[model samples]
Target: MSYVDFSSDAFIAAFFLYCFAFLFYVVTIAGKKWSNRDPIKHEQRWSRISFVTSTLGLIAHLTFFFTRWIGSGQIPTSNMYEFITFLGMAIMIAFTIVYAIYRKPLLGMFALPLVVLVVAYASVFPQEVQPLIPALSSIWLKVHVTTAALGEAFFAVGFAAGLMYLLRVVDFKQTSKEAKRDQFWVEFSLYTIVLVIGFIAIVFIFRGAGYQATFTQENVTIDSKGVDHSSTDTAEYTLPPIVKPYNSTADHMDSFLGMDKPLFEAPSWMKGVNAGRKLNTVIWSVIAGSILYGLIRLLFRKRIGAVIHPLMGDIDPDDLDEISYRAIAIGFPVFTLGALIFAMIWANIAWGRFWGWDPKEVWALISWLYYSAYLHFRLSRGWQGKRSSWLAVIGFVVILFTLVGVNLVIAGLHSYAGV
Candidate 1:
């Protein structure tokens, strides 16, 4: 089989491994009675198991992509699916680094499921092998896409850690009688897992059974005046018959193939509208992510920190905050160079224009500016702890929208994502 096929299978396997790790981590969190052990010993044993499983899963994830690169003879960011997979890999690597430094395996209890969700979401996009379009055939493709993905990955890790940090702060135990902090954490963790998995399933369903494509064959018709008008002038197209399938890959590929070209077509007047749409996608993702976070807290009848109280018992909040900031500090410059400078250079080479104000380019600048403001606030405004943590969280959402959501939902020059 081709590298694409191999990478597909590997992604599927890594996804399930992450799911298994998530389940194991949950069992560990619930302790011996629910997880089957004495509380203290069970907690320790479960921590070890969670760490090992997550490490193995990360290794599998890296191997999957490396093999994909070898198979495809190029970096994996050729399309939305590849970009998401690459982004997930970067997130996993970042999480592993944080885990190694802080010895905080509990973070994986939240992070791995996210990685799985994104990879699975990516799977919903068409996975077929297609030659790179002329515009994308450049060495800068590697530098731009890979660096942007890595930057987003680090931000994703920061967001996960920040959420955990928020949960650690609010003292949910002090907030309500009905809410025990540990109970809240366990419940929220599970809920987040469900939501992530559910979103991926929704995308899969939409691509598979929820939408149809209709293509009218190229045709022409002549008028009574013998004008020699082609049928294409009057031909009408209708939605194709819906195909139901347990798996989305085949259906998505069929739909994509049936369409003669890319999913988006921009009018001349809207030449740069794709860039605006990208900004909108990024903005909306941040809004949606914040709302989802609020809903999770509401469902538990407590604040976020209350849910993860047990994990914070021996851990210092200051340390967690430092780790969160440090990760962003390292990731920000890399993100700026990759998502902005490299992208502009590549765009200039391919389209003969570097700063076109295209939606993708504009949103990328927005992300760069937002993070720059974050750093400025940190240094000049003395933004630290909860305030800085919130910025990190917000910055990540912007980075995500700039990376994945923009390519998936927006029509732009970067529409080469083949969504």
Candidate 2:
């Protein structure tokens, strides 16, 4: 097999290993109350097993990265698929670091799933290796993308810990106005996560079934000589189109559940790279996520938060809060180095400017500022516990928008990475 093929196998192995690790971690927590086993010994044994499995998974992921790098003759972070996979691996590394510091096996229960979800989401994009464009062919590409992803990975761990703290501390049975508000938001956060999973699920389902739709759209570009040029490009869809591209018609669409045509054309103002398809994806995610959430609610017969909060009975909320804080604190400076400083240096080298108001750049700045305020509130303003956890949680949402949302919704210098 070629090195790329071997890397593909390694990637699959890593994904399965992560899934097994997540299950073992779940057993470490959920099987503690079993009839035949000592709870403390059971947790210790299973936690060790889970940690080993996750570490092996990380090793396999590393093998995939290096092998792919060797095969492609370029670092794999130039595109969405490779970058998200790398992000998943970085999250595992961050998780290992925090797990070592805290020796908390339960953290694996939260962290491994995030890794699995991220890796799975990476599969939603095309996975072929493509030649790097002139803009990305720099040594700084390695430094900037890897460091930034590593920093974001730490924030992801902080998010997991902060979320765990919330589940541990929040009163599930309270009915007062403030308590209700808290409950609603916690559930909403979970629902949002479910939406991402739903999106990945729907995409793979259609892709595996060989579903496809194609459209031809006209493009207009201005030349360096200030001339208008027109061209036609093909747009393809894996999911049935609810909304077609603006100023375009379908070349062909496979009938899905008897829906063979697009229901609407995207608005002219919504122009962006794959704007209509992205909007369709968002719509499908909400639809699938709501259905999945409803099913889970039916199975549990309670709010998802209430279902999870009980499992957190033995965990200390204060430790979780501190873990969240320290992880973010460690990540903040690294993010500044990667996302801002190294990024600016690379931008100057490539674009002959230190900064441009690209959507990705703006959002990166927003993420930096957001986390800066997070640290300020945590340290200078004396925010701790729930308030601090909330910041960590929301900070990750901002980071996600910077990483994924900006690429999906806006066309800019970074648009090539979206491919």
Candidate 3:
């Protein structure tokens, strides 16, 4: 097989290995209570096995990265698919480093699934390697994207550990108003994660089924000469359309679940030709996520947090909090250097400006300032445990919005990265 094909195979192998490692980590925790098992020996043996499996997966992932670079003759971070897969790989690297230091099996249980989810999400984007545009043809692309992703990977680990801290410490059985509010937000956070999974799952489901719809959208523009220009663009959808593009007509739509056409037109305020499609996707994701969450709730007959809380009873909340803090602390300076400093340097070379106030740049600043505040609150204000954990968790969300939401929802210089 060709190197690119081999790289694809390696990626598949890595994905399965990560999944197996997650299963083994789950066994390490759950099997401790099994009859006829020595809990200590069982935990030790299974944790070791899981860690080895995860390490092998990371190796396979690295093989994919290098081989793809060889085949493509370029670093793979120029596009959404490549960058996200690289992010997943970076997360694994970060997880492996933290796991070695802490030797905590529970970390694998959370971190591996996150790696799996992220890699899976990356798979939804197109994977063919494309040549970088002139704006992206720079050594700084490698430095900025790779370093920024590595830093984000550490934040991802921090988020996982912080989430674990919450699960371990949150009072699931409490009935008071304050406790109930905490319970709601924790459950909501878990639910939001499920939404992401649901989004990925639904996307692949329709894509595999070869579902498609087409729309013709018209655009009108006013030039400096006071002349109106009109143009047409095609909008396509793999999922059934719940909403159609603004000022557009369906070229063709395959009937889905007895619905032959969109139920509504996109809001006029949504300007892009693809805005309707993106909005439709968001709606579908919510639907799929709600259904998935409902099934899980039904299966357990308890809030998801309550179910996970029992598994975390033996874990140390203090250790989880420390791990979360340390991971973010290590990541903060690296993020500052990559997402801001190197980015500005690259920006100057590409656009002749170091600071453009583009949506992406603005959000990147927001993420930096947020993390700066996180560190300040952590070190100066003496926030620890729940407060620090919450900051870590929320900080990752801000990073994600900076990475994804800005690309999808806002048009700017970074729109090239959007799917």
Instruction: Work out the TM-score per prediction.
Output: 0.72, 0.97, 0.99
lDDT of 1 by residue, 1-419 (tens): 87667767777778888888888877776555454446778877877888788778778788788888898787777887777788888888888888788876667777887787787877866776557888999999999988877877777777777766766675654547434554455355445445555555544554566453332322344788887754321111112222211111221223433643333332334323223233333333344445666676689776454555655565577877777777777788888889888998998999998899887898988988887898899889998887887787767767766766566566778878844
Superposed Cα deviation of residue 368, candidate 2 (Å)? 0.8
Model 3, residue 188: displacement in angstroms?
0.2
**Candidate 3 minimal-lDDT segment of 10 residues:** 30-39
Q: Which stretches of candidate 1 lie over 4 Å from their true place?
A: 32-44, 171-196, 205-315
Candidate 2 Cα deviation (angstroms), residue 325: 0.4
The residue pairs found clashing in candidate 2 are none
Model 2 over residues 257-349: C-alpha lDDT tens digits? 989899999888887437888889998899889999999999999999999999999998889999999999999899999999999999998
True lDDT of residue 259, candidate 1: 48
| TM-score of decoy 3 | 0.99
Q: Write the per-residue lDDT of candidate 3 for residues 76-125, one digit (tens) a residue.
A: 89888999999999999999999889999999999999999999999988
TM-score between model 1 and native: 0.72
Winner by lDDT: 3
Model 1: per-residue Cα lDDT at residue 306: 52
